[model samples]
Target: MTLFWAGAYALTRVAVDKGNPDMGLPVAWVLPGRLTIGAAVLWVLMLARGQKLPPLRDRKRWVAIIGMGLAGSVFPFFLITTAQETVNSSLAA
Candidate 1:
């Protein structure tokens, strides 16, 4: 997890760097791409292990899942990507 996060930070920095427009990618593209790919990979792994998703009808479970996703994944990704525009990746990490 540490290594994964470190790499992500570095990649985010690269993606947001204005000095390297050729290499830099838009935040709009990078964030969604990262999230989608990560989610898909995890979903595949879970399916391979026969893990079941929580029932969508469970309100509490749905709330918890949404909260965790926003807090743990989405918020941080947005914050980091935005910050990387002004801060160095090494410092952001």
Candidate 2:
């Protein structure tokens, strides 16, 4: 998780450096795209390694997953990238 967050921060800083003031990427790729790709890669790795994923069958687990996705996934995805748009990665850290 730490590594993932660090990579997200790095990606956001780099993407921001290449994007516009509006945080728009006129090109084919963007920060969110990169983050999605990273997630996909990690998911694939976990699957290949036969790692057990979160059980979303339970109501409580579902809620936890939703909360985690919103808090740990989506929130950081936007915040880190947007922050990187204006601040240096080291300073943001």
Candidate 3:
């Protein structure tokens, strides 16, 4: 898991580096693309394993879901990807 995350940061740095020829991906494109793909893949796996989502009508559940989504995944991803733009991936990771 540590290596995987490290590699992810390295790849992110490469992708987000605008000066790299034919390899540079826009910073704007990185976060959304990564998050969406990650989310889709996780959903597919969860469905395959027959894991059901929690009840949507539960207010407490929704709050926790939204909080985790923003704080746990989205915020961290955004910070790291953004950081890679101006800093080395190894340091950013």
Among the numbered candidates, top TM-score falls to 1
Off by over 4 Å in 3: 18-23
Candidate no. 1 TM-score: 0.84
TM-score to true structure, per model? 0.84, 0.62, 0.82
* Shift of residue 4 alpha carbon in model 1, Å: 2.2
lDDT (CA) per prediction: 0.85, 0.68, 0.83
Q: What range of 10 consecutive residues in model 1 has the weakest lDDT sum?
A: 14-23
**lDDT, candidate 1, 15-74, per-residue tens:** 777467567787888888899999999999999999989988999999999999999989
Residue lDDT tens for model 2, 1-93? 798767656756666663456554522346458757868998999999999777666788879877987797677656656666667777776
User: Looking at candidate 1, what is the lDDT of residue 50?
Assistant: 98
Alpha-carbon runs more than 4 Å astray in model 2 = 1-8, 18-31, 52-57
The sequence of per-residue lDDT tens digits that candidate 3 reaches over residues 1-93 is: 788767888888888983563567776798889888889999999999999888888889899989999999888888888777778877887
lDDT, residue 87, candidate 2? 73
- Sequence-dependent TM-score of model 3: 0.82
* Worst ten in a row by lDDT for model 3: 18-27
**Model 1 segments more than 4 A misplaced:** 20-23
